[model samples]
Target chain A: MKQNSLFLDRATIVSPHVNGWDEFLASLNCQDVISFEEDWRAQLESLPMRSRRRLSPQILLAISVAEKIHETLPKETAWVFASSVGEGETLNVILDALGTPEKAIQPLRFQNSVHNAASGQWTIAAGVKCPVTSINAHNYTVGAGFLKASMQIKSENCPVGLVLYDAPLPYPLSASHKINIPLGVGFALKPEPSANTIAELKISYCKTPNPMPFASLPQIPENSYNPILAVFPLLKCLAGSPQEDIFLGLNKDYGLCIKVKQL
Target chain B: MLQHPRTNNCGITHSSIVTCLGYGRSSHLLALREGRSGLSNNHGLDLQFDCYLGKVPDVEGIGFPSRVADFDNRATRLALAALVTDGFEQAVLKIRNRWGADRCGIVLGTSTSGVEMLEKTYKAIPENGAMPEDYSTRHHDNLHAITTFLQEYLGFTGPGYTISTACSSSAKALVDACQLVESGLCDAVLTGGVDSLCMTSLYGFESLELMSKVPCRPCDASRDGLSIGEAAAFMIVERDADGYLKLSGYGESSDGTSMSTPPPDGSGASQAIKAALERANLTPNDIDYVNLHGTATIVNDSTEAKAVETAVYRSVPASSVKGAIGHTLGAAGAAEAVFCQYALEDEVIPGNTGLIDLDPALLPNVSESCRNGQLRHVISNSFGFGGSNCALVLSR
Candidate 1:
């Protein structure tokens, strides 16, 4: 296995407990756990009212976080946007329309129903035109996103913007999506360190004979089915210790383990 | 695409495709050679529009092996149906024995996953505000459904993820699989996509006025819109292939212009094409044929045509397979790339299906017939919603 190092130049976390990365780090405590609501929306006072009116909570969260680090990124930045269940509410709306005889659907609703809706919104808002991959891997969305973002930086020698976010699915669809808290996290990952770099991480694909258990990690929420929340432990380690190991539980048999050292 | 040299080549060691044209690579190649359009009168949908579609045959009859019955869904069944054919399953088993399970991985892409199941769940919601007992949001409509099912069915787990950037999902998944292999994460990776047709995509496109009332005529002056199709295309990308097409290079670009409409300048698609060419370390001259994204839409065809005309080698023989397979949405990337593989093998460039009157705006390279010739490298383009675009360069 090869060890690839990525310097986390800047990151922003959006959850119920904290509004930005600085707040998150300042408020970081092992015992203090916070839960984000399924459709949490606060006054995104930084953005214009016109822009705020059109975006979903998850997209808004992504933009808010990306805005914090987008300036540090290159003009043509590659992005890997990952979410477990994307725009489930929008899908329900479209599904309801298709279920009827008339099948009258809205154009805007169909546009937002795609899994990459947030990626579209965030890119337009940020005005960065490189490339983006909107993806998901069950509860492994965070680790998968990091793996994808890190690989893009390593292989292509480019700075990558990684965003992991998810909101609640609507109705009977919500039955299987056990996520109680909707959360999002964005990072500007680079191959080399910048002045604003916060941490350096070495990622390796390790053979896990017995996959790591989520129950061992207390920072992870009980009802947190959103894969973005898996990054919470990594953030906690970055905030507390110099050297730490965290397994991003991507699937039952495999995951990405990162060794994070704060710069 | 970008023209740069790569360290090691990723090969299309094994692959399978199941569409309305038929199952297996030979079936598709036969249909392509015969110039058969899979576009047929739309059935199995509740839409009122008179558009054509490429429907997978016997999708309902596609069932799981009794061992993997619990992971059954329309998408998974479609994937397994293709996997069981083309010796893909046997190949995977052999690769597993050679590399061990931990060194083999799978990544599948889907735009709608189990949205059909979501529609069913929408119907079965009780008055008491309870979901149907059979409905599973996690296992059904979630993006992980296809990948999870494949991992469980195969019982081979390494690093896996699902990409869902509309049409470019599977192409990007192949790039991701190549990286996994390059990073020493896995020796063999199942990289492709499976997106089934559903009311959401059908009616959704109809709402956007993107659905054509007839079979799609890509690169044609008579073209109005696209006949959306359903498919499951999978390929195992590994090293040391004997007689397989190589995944030499790939490029991805986000238009950053519109959600649905591509940039009129065609620079976004050009970026991907340029990046892929650069990575392949080949000029436009090196690319013998290109399987265009040709969704038969007015704006997409014009923009992509212009992009290839200027940025890529305009003289490169290009044709859209959408006329035969219809626009497979998320599966289009892998579907078209596999079509390029078969095209290289057969030395026949697929004709622009449904094309009668060629578009005046298009270059002469868009073929009207399945011409036979010596072919080598081919470029496959897949542009999608959210402005995400990916281009892959394949070599024989």
Candidate 2:
């Protein structure tokens, strides 16, 4: 089958360590000290208290980046948001309220608990009637979001806005899967072809026929702790070049390899 | 093309596709026929609800590779179990070899993807901002875990995606898969869904007061709520061939009302079902059985029951399997569709296990156990959060 004719209009990343384009690019360095506290402060101050209570900093960062890249109102394009730690902070509040029977469940928090809450907020904020899909795929969360967006372009022949975001884990629960990096949000404005031409997105996957080339990269031992290091290859591929045919290989062993070309 | 040319040949054909090819539930037909329930009480720390779950029994005894163990979300295990058995591996291999991996694709749906792992991580994070060593490598964020797993297991290099629209996730996945095939994007597609028991889901449902304390009884007046279960169901959906069950039609619509509650009138669901029938070039009378998204929730049951009555032929037999296996969340659509296929193949309508007497005020097709009949064309409904609705029509 011929690959769908979809183009990446723009891609944006927002995190506590960076807000605008330049800062986001710089924070890609592993040494940067990105703090969720600082990021959340900036995000919370921008929204009204009511909206703040309903939308988390992670969601806000994602929407802000997506809105900037898409430039169009949310209503103009279909929305698909992907997340790993979805509304964990809000869930914490709900669990705490449940602990004390005197505290009735907060309707705002309750409404925000659904996985699609971020997409809903984006829809209302954008005032767009386009469909919104919210998905969660633990490790492949973003990749899955990208795939779905691609499929929509092929099957529905419509432009799609893809948003990927995750916040730092809340306390207690944070102890389970801890990350020191600041909250992260990535957005790609994917548009369908208007005319017969330009670059298109093509994705493929295959089973590993031979052993993977893990030996090429520096091994981090068997149980080393890393944060987004594995995905650096994919990010680098997307950010480093303006290429036509970008090949993202998520190994059968779950390792990822990215190759790009300018056609 | 806005609509594919092959749209007429796409749908959920059987009243139920019940094949006992995996580990979770044994004797799929026998269990439903005898009204046997598969849910057992789970005693995990994160799980707060004292309820029954339709968990795959004796899975721990199966020796999975350590690498596979590292990706230990219940969804992966269940999907692998289903794919490795029942000639699934051979089928996948055949397609990959013939079409090339890139020509084969995968579309899976699930409401939760290893959220239990997230829950575990959340409980471990300290205030100092140090994560566990395995957090980064964990496949928790990658929606492609299942796709990658299948890619590795089956060696397919095709497009892959994970649909997450609450309970309707997998049902919609199947619909998307059919569309992909009909559009000529792929010669074959792996469509299914998987979800496991987790604290986030349990508490989330319990907080809404939707979890039933006792076993679930769909269409019964005495039924109070739902029993949350865990499962993974998959189907190798290919283009219409000589022996394959032709996916005749599919329809999807969204209401955008509320995530937890469906539209009171079942308009969105009815629209999807009707659209599917229209796409299949069939009338309500052509449907032999209707497998409902009967979660047993008061509002869901009432609304879905009404939709089936209004949209389907009056004489079509309709029932919900939640009575026997509990609500499998993301896997419900594919799992139930499998049951519908089995009904068509076996020539029997498995009874609605736990319903002793249908609600007097509800529609008339509700019944207690499977009935012997010549089943052929069937419709399966899967409604999810955010008012996402999907209906599939399959024919033998």
Interface RMSD of each candidate, angstroms, one decimal: 2.4, 4.9
User: Candidate 2's residue-wise lDDT over A51-128, tens digit each?
Assistant: 755576555655675666566323335567777556666766764554443434555566566566666565545544
> Alpha carbon lDDT of residue B367, candidate 2?
75
Number of backbone collisions per candidate, in order? 15, 65
Which regions of candidate 2 fall more than 4 Å away from where they truly are? A7-52, A62-78, A84-115, A120-131, A136-144, A166-263, B1-26, B40-50, B73-75, B84-87, B117-131, B135-144, B179-185, B309-315
Each candidate structure's TM-score, on Cα atoms with residue i matched to residue i, is: 0.95, 0.76
- List where candidate 1 sits over 4 angstroms from the true fold: A29-39, A42-48, A209-213, A219-225, A241-243, B1-7
> Among these predicted structures, which one has the highest DockQ?
1
Q: What tens-digit string does per-residue lDDT give for candidate 1 at B77-166?
A: 789888888898999889888888888888888899877776766776654476666666666788888888888878777888899998
Deviation (Å) of B298 in candidate 2: 1.0
